[model samples]
Structures are given as structure tokens and as C-alpha cells.
Target: MTASRPHELVEDPEYFRDVLNSMRMIADKNLRRVRFGLTGDGIAPHYEITVPDGDYMEHSVRFPINGLTHHTHHQSPEPFEVTNLTEKFSWDDVIGMLERALSRKRERK
Candidate 1:
């Protein structure tokens, strides 16, 4: 898991929605499915973009609940890697990270 010094309290509903919206835009452009929702009494939120590789294979870029860091999880034969953001980041940063991870996966195909 990746760890970073929390910069903002994204637990707020409005902020969370905005973040998800921004991520959805990226997912739409990249042909990925965005899955996100609030968890744990509506305090923590989690978002993920899953990119399908084939009929039965896929990979995901996830921002886990309560964690500001981003990580990539691939299917068998690939390993998970976490990236820690040490500075304040916006939704663009997250989207860029996801795009980069997806690009790398494509190269491996």
C-alpha cells in the first residue's frame, strides 16, 4: 500500500462527487469502467478504474478508501505497484497516474 501525508479531507460529499466526476471523464476517454462510492458511514470514499484486457482478464487502478495514494493491480503474471504522492494533488494528478498505468499495461500486451 502507498502512504502519503494527507493534504485535504476529501470525506466531504460535494468534494468527493467532484473528484469522481473528474475521474469519470478520464475513464470515459480511455474506455475504462469507473467504480466509486462512499464507504464506512459515508466518511471514506473509494474509486477505481477497471480496464478490461480480454473476455476474462482485467486490471485496475485504485484509490483505496481513506488513502490518498494511488496503486495499480493487475491480473496474474503482473505485480502490484504503489505510488506515493508526497505533495498536495488534484483529480488531474490521479487521472494522469491512471493513464500512465494503463499505458504501461498496454505496452505489456
Candidate 2:
């Protein structure tokens, strides 16, 4: 049998733009007080969704790209939780996680 060729991965700017657009659509549909954009350097990017609880308290879900992995951080008064989603990541996964964290913050308020 002939050996199969390795799949090629292309880093097209259009593809990146499409991905960002999809995330923006998700944020527009479901999230409030959202702030999202590529970092100035274009080497690392991040998006944050915040739910303000009070003057001093807030719940935040942050997605930051580190190397080749996508890392998530949930910040709150209880404790900081970090998750790496590079293995099996999807837009739905990110959205769901944010929703859960926001819900918990709302419940506590």
C-alpha cells in the first residue's frame, strides 16, 4: 500500500478572520459586556467576557492563545481556574464554559 501524505495546515489570514468573525457572532448573540480583538502584536490573541457583580467584584472568562494551545481562565472571588482546551476545543465549548461561569456568578449575587 502506498503511504498516505500528511495533511497540510495553512495559516491563511482569511481563515483567521473567519474564525474571529465566528467568535464575534457568538459573543454578539449570547454574551454581554464582551471585549474581543486580536492583540496588537498579532502573535498572541485574547478575548474576555466580563459580568460585573458589584463595584469591586466581577466574573470574567478569558481565552488566551499560548503557543499552539488555547488556554481559558475563569476569574472570580472564590479562586482562579485555568483550563487548556487545545486538545478538543470548539466554539461551543468556549461559549458553554463561559455561560456556566456567568450563571454561577449570577447565582452568588
Candidate 3:
């Protein structure tokens, strides 16, 4: 038998677009008046969403797509909550987590 090769992952822009669109649909269904966009390219793309707090101040969070699902505030390493999607996460899980994050009302001090 011939030596087996490791499976290489290819960067598919179309697939990425589809994922982005799906995320947008979820956001539209759950959240209101939020702006969504993409940040970065290739394999390290992130989903950026700007949500308005109680004071109407826009707060943006970036969610990386490569590993465990988590959202960061202003590029901080401290994520709101870490959920390992590699275990048993699904699109429903994503919607729940994202809705929680987006719906959180930030206090204005």
C-alpha cells in the first residue's frame, strides 16, 4: 500500500461567503438595527457585529471562525463566554449564544 497523505484544507471564498450570509440571517432574525461585516481574509476571517447598548452606544464584537466559538470585545482576549464547537455545537447553539451576546445591555457609568 502507498503512503497516505494528510488531508489539506483549502480556502474556499464561496463557502466563507455562505457562512457569513448565514450568520447575517441569524442576526437579522434575532437582533435589531445591527451592522455586520467581515474582517480579514483567507483562513482567518472574522464576523464583526456592532450592537447598540442601552445608552445607544455602539459596541462591536469580533467572532473568529477557526476554533472554539467565542466573541471578543474591542479585540480583547477576554471572551464573553467560550463554547467549544468542536465538541457538540450546532447552528442552533450558535444562534442562542449570539443572541445572548447581542442582547446583553451594557451599563453606562
Go through the candidates in order and give each one's C-alpha lDDT. 0.39, 0.35, 0.33
Candidate 2 Cα outliers beyond 4 Å, as residue runs: 1-86
Q: Over the stretch 58-92, how does candidate 2's per-residue lDDT look in tens digits?
A: 64444332212323433323322233112223455
Among all windows of ten consecutive residues in candidate 3, which has the lowest summed lDDT? 1-10
Better candidate by lDDT, 2 or 3: 2
What is the lDDT ranking, best to worst?
1, 2, 3
Candidate 1, after superposition: displacement of residue 100 in Å?
31
**Model 2, global lDDT:** 0.35
- Of candidate 1, the 10-residue stretch with the lowest lDDT total is 1-10
In model 3, which regions exceed 4 Å deviation?
1-11, 29-41, 52-62, 67-109
> What's model 3's overall lDDT?
0.33
Worst 10 residues of 2 by lDDT: 1-10
lDDT (Cα, tens digit) per residue for candidate 3, span 1-109: 1111100121333433344344563344444322222222223233333333444446644343331132333454442232311222234544444444344422211
Pairs of colliding residues, candidate 2? none
* Order of the predicted models by TM-score, top scorer first: 1, 2, 3
